[model samples]
Target chain A: MIKVKKEFILKYGVPSLAVIIVAIQLCLVHFQDLSRWKGGGFGMYTEIHYFYNQIHVSGMSVDSLIKDDPSMRSTLGYLMLMPNDKNIKKAAELVLKTTHKDSVYLQIWKPIVNSENGLYKKVLANEIHLKKSEL
Target chain B: MNYWSAIEIKLKDQIALASQLLLFMLGSYVFILAEEHKLWKILVLFFGLIAWLFFRNKTKHPIIWIVFFVLLTIDLFYSYFWVANHHFMLVFMVLSVILFSYHKQSDILLKNIQLLLVIVLLASVMQKITSKQFMSGDFYYHAINLGGLFKFFFTIFPESLEIAKSNSESLTTLKELNPNLTEHIVLKDVFPNLSFVSRVFAWLTVIFEFLVAVAILWKPKKIGTHIIFIILLFGILFTRLETGFVSLLAISGLYLCKNIKLKLLYVLIILGCITLIITKFGYH
Candidate 1:
């Protein structure tokens, strides 16, 4: 074993250990899915569950995807307005599609886009209350 | 030497070690509570422990504190809302460490720490007093009923029959709606007539917070006052188990002891930190 001086350890040890700990912590971000999931229950909805899961599916930044695709926006809008796994999974699926040319996401979008009553805009505006900043 | 002089000497000698112990304890709690994987949390805690032991006495350098700050900031970003109170404590510890390193003066650092504690306590009092739900005791009632503490107490106490009966029904409905909300209710609330004891506890919480704010500034050299502060802190910790105990341990060390042998305290804190971090593995 290599010999390390007590004084040297005293000076560099804690900070080095701290850096290592931080590095490990940062690395764990990649495996968040495997570690745990706090999906909402009790009639309430968790927006971030959809937000992060959808982001993973889309492989794009939230703002960039929302800007580039109407379907992604509507999926998010559906998530904010509607509760349940089916709708949320539909939103996640929308992100995986190559383009929004087809009206496959219409059911999710109808409430958010087709209304002249401004209900869609209200739902979209309510996204500000969402816990996940990325969503 | 007079009593006041003895107390002052004790405080001057032990405050640094006490603050360090507090930081270690708080850091440990945060590590365990952080939203990360078991392997990662363990790795971080193991390395962090070795590092903390090495630098426990090296308060002379600012780099150690800066490193801790950087780690805390990263943890804050990863679990922004879950561990917010833990983040707050880290921020205070980091700021205090920086101040102590630069000034290299015990008196100035103590004063600043005192100021920070006072502000925190006063702010808690202000929040309690201003909140409509908190004042009316509804918040506490819901919290206690939800946390199951009310049921626990109801079972033990014969005189609390009214509260027990009413709160049991409420608990069933609330838990059915959201099973997780019943985890940790810090308020110790009681419903049904807002029972005299629960109301007293509620008002006393606000008053005690205010008194703690006052105690920090009233007489720094009095042993009696420090004891009162420690008791008040423990009282708060009883209701709120998460972050209050760390502060209690810290304040006990900083303001209570005169010439404490910190080796034992440090070991205990380190152990607790490890245990807490281990607890975090799958919690998040």
Candidate 2:
């Protein structure tokens, strides 16, 4: 049994040690995060989601489709509970038509409200004007 | 309509990303240079190279696998799960299982792979179990999504309802993505066949992982089997695992391989590596 064990170690043990060393080398290539390596993480889609969700909160009806679809109950959790914001109501109406019409992201009409358009960028950036009473 | 806004590139960060890529490239290349200068001086280098190549065989494309793994480990240790990382983790867990079956080794590569998967799974489970408070409050709270049957329990509990109902928004793919996505939408996705797909994969994964122990034990009597298994591992690396291709290149250097065979595999792998660099660094 001793001899057999020795033979096993001699044959496979050496090779195994080598693989581990290489793995360590490969593991060192990451710049701290797995997603960072793949061009993920900091994409504009995140901003878009944030932008639309805010619009939905400001009295936009685009989220109504989500509530209608029970499957979306979990995903649209925050959108369903909060009543739409008042000041952004007109902007929300324009945003909702486009969001609900084609993509369902609640910001389809965003093209009409270009980044050059003052309110569009503000909504996209998540900055809302505070009313005196609310303040 | 302007979904294209999803890509927010920071041109200034290129300096940092480029520096990192260069560091790993040069670091990994030193071993190859040494191997060229002397035949058997780098025994450890030899073995590491072979393991990397065998794992990256299928894609016939070379990649910066070592970089991928290193980055992945950093993310795990640093606690950044983001949705993409979640996908990458799932990919890694699957690849580890496949490689665990190839070649006989005394080192704990196979065992370590298994251990890593277990650690990740346990971490995911714990994250969910402890977030019962958050789950009760946030409707889109993943304390339920990929969390599986736990959603049912949370749904009926009045305490959970009041808290969970506090928020009324659907869960987005990018929301709270770092640790695990499966925990939240498990209940809402309610697709009939999707659960079946997930279940099949889960069971198969476990079985394949345990099979590594057996594969190692049987390797001595199955020399030919070892070659085939090693190649299969390479396929899993290149195809299923992103950084695995570079690893295959590193490990392949460890063993004395046939020139012709190495050349063939190298061609396929080179294309992949080039693509990765171009996509990642804008190199032609």
Cα lDDT tens digits for candidate 1, B1-284: 59856645544546665666655655565554555534455555567667767876775555546555656666666544334333544555566667567656565556555655554455456545644445554445544543434344555665565554554564334323322123321222233444444446668778876776687667654655455665664454355443333443344336334434333342343344335444642111
Residue-level lDDT tens digits of model 2 in B1-284: 44324212311232222223333443433322333324333444455467566766655323334433443444334323222323333334323323333433423333333333333333323222333222222211222222322344555565654444432233344232321212322223322343344334334433443343344344422444334434544543432333333433322221212233442343344445444544552111
Model 2 has how many clashing residue pairs? 68
Give candidate 1 misplaced runs (Cα > 4 Å): A1-135, B1-12, B33-62, B148-193, B243-249, B252-284
- Error (Å) of candidate 2 at residue B62 is 24
User: What lDDT score is found at residue B208 in candidate 1?
Assistant: 77
State which candidate has the highest TM-score.
1
TM-score of 1: 0.51
